[model samples]
Target: MTSHRYAQWLRDSAFGSLPHPAISIAVTLGYLAALYPGTLPRDTTITAVLTTVFSALGACTGRVLARRSRGRPEEQARRIVFGSCLVILGSAVGMAVWWQNLIRSAVDVAPAGVGWCAAATLPAAVVVVAIVAVPRTAAVVAAGALALTAGLLAPADAGADEQRLPVSSSAQHDPGTLLRGELRVGEFDAAAADLARSWTASGGLSARAVVVAVPTGSGWVDSAAVDGFGSRFAGDVRVLTLPYDQVPSWQAFVSDRSGSAESAIAVVSAVATVLDSVPEHERPRVILYGQSLGAVGADAARVWLENEHPSLLDETVLVAPPAGTVALLSRTPRTVLANSSDPVVRWSFAELWRPHGATGDTHVRGPRVPDAPWLPVISFVQTSVDLLGALDGAAGVGHRYGPEQAGPPHPLRN
Candidate 1:
């Protein structure tokens, strides 16, 4: 009698856990379905409403089965069988709708492949349901163990290829001249490194040039930027790493306030002070470079320089300027390099700017390629990996921006 009672208890426990596993599976499917971008070709609203309804039904069925099993044994058994069927059917319907719609829409192409691959484990799903319905704790444990083993053995590469590349020694170069004035406080070092690399990669055009690297992200840190690219400039490249920390955060300053413009004004004042201190022949040509969030900083600098210190800036390069910044720096001849696969730039252009009315040339898109010769304006496209790698301080040849492959015999007509 005790053995029979133990067996009954085990069965009850398994029945209770069934709904949880089912709900988990359904939730996973729903998440995967939502990852598909773009509008649904069919009535998305109806499809979405139905998907939610089926998910709720599956959850409710599981709960009813778990509760009914604890009250009347006969009723519990009936509900268990019926509830399992409903849960399975509901999940199937949801999956079928999602799968069918995915096949019909181009946006769903990637997700469809993923979903079909996930659905290949239908046998495992059945085993999960069985384990949940079983009352014996030992049997439930065995089933779980089996499920885990099957999942582990599924065919897939578990590791990624790890490789290393030679590090660039360009991060040790020094600034030939120091612009004497109040430094724009911020992470100037990071921006300086990128500018230095660009200057060096351009065969030393940055030599002896006053490279003004505006700080748009954080406190100015000139060590990284200066050390990275300073050694490659042909002449002494004077780095004026702006310190923009007088404000709270760099992001807040760019988004909420006009601190960047104010910072640019301060930088302009410092540049004038430096130019005045140096002999007429010793003054370097000013080249401005900024990236990512710093692109906004570069924009503010361009506006300030063109409007206030026009004589100081020789050329400006704005790499991946934030949306709406194009107009800010439109009057200044600028080169905007964007990552072809960068979601930030793509979304910003497609959703943000296009919806509103903003007109600015997108120099490059698709993949990160070598820099093209567009006279005073040069645009370089970088791969996502290359861009992220460079940003993360990874030393690699892939991170280097070189000359373009093919283009017109000459640069774009001025």
Candidate 2:
């Protein structure tokens, strides 16, 4: 009887422990999937699916190990559940980190299809793991992480093509309006006609309005200068592209400059110049739009406008502004749109807080406007695909300072 009881105790304990290698390998592969879904061939989607199944099995095996090591049935169940939850949480964090890294890379690499694939699959995989494993605590954690990941990484498809404004036949009449130019900084340019088209399309606005887009990084291309604004605003809008390399004078102005900070100053200065040059009467209700590095540029410009030239800015929009800029700038009346799910923003906050003991709340100092009643529009695109798609499709364009959409416009104040 004594030997049998000892044997049972060993079995329960063994069942409660997880397989370290299995967890390690699954987590590593999951992260890789989050980073480069296209690295696996289309033929390999099945393989990827199978790998996830194996991961689930591995998790179960760990639970079994835990169950075996503990003798009491209730205790065994608790241990199994707890261990599974931890593993899932760890996997989720790993995936989020991987996704952020992938996005930063995709800004330079193309055939962006890979980035899209990764963005779509990472969250789905997390869901599958949660459902299949089904440990109560683990499932809850997996769900939360999945929600957060989807919110961050899934918006990629929405704005992938947002480099230029869409040009219809009407755009041809204005020769001066058809500015075909490009700016080069290091490896990136401020604007491209194709990107502008994508941007216009994403906003659901007619490509025939006065639109102004600012692409900040490396340098702004002529396309960014002319087409981005001219095509949308019908030559009424002036696109001011600020190339990072072209701003030596402004670069000297920022006291302790990081590359991002320099880019911000350059863009703000460029926008200020454009605003100054325009005959106030001809300037269409100016809307400032920025993405990624451009977001930092937009934020900086908004700050400058608020501090130095508040009269010049009519409306402003920033997508995925860097955490540093978000932290530094004061709240303004501009409409700021951000992705709650974006891993880049999240990770940036994590990096910031890890060193400085700050919270994500520190970066929340933007205008409170919601997506409607546009005087100072504040919109938060929920999904990556939707945000990117709106930017690409011209669905996200236009300047309406009133309520026209279905959802309650996110109020600017509160």
Q: Which candidate tops lDDT?
A: 1
lDDT of each: 0.43, 0.40
Tens digit of per-residue lDDT, candidate 2, span 213-306: 4443333332433444443444543343433433321132233224444444444444455446656765445455555555565566567667
Give me the runs in candidate 2 sitting further than 4 Å from their true place: 1-212, 216-232, 245-261, 267-286, 322-332, 339-414
lDDT of 1 by residue, 216-321 (tens): 4343333444443354343356655444443323244335535455555555555555465656665666666655455566667787777776766666655545
Shift in Å, residue 150, candidate 1: 31
- What TM-scores do the predictions have? 0.44, 0.38
State, as a TM-score between 0 and 1, how close model 1 is to the true structure: 0.44
Judged by whole-model lDDT over C-alpha atoms, candidate 2 comes out at: 0.40
Which ranges of candidate 1 are over 4 A from the true structure?
A: 1-29, 32-34, 37-207, 220-233, 246-257, 273-283, 326-329, 346-359, 365-414
**lDDT assessment of candidate 1:** 0.43
Lowest lDDT 10-residue stretch of candidate 1: 376-385
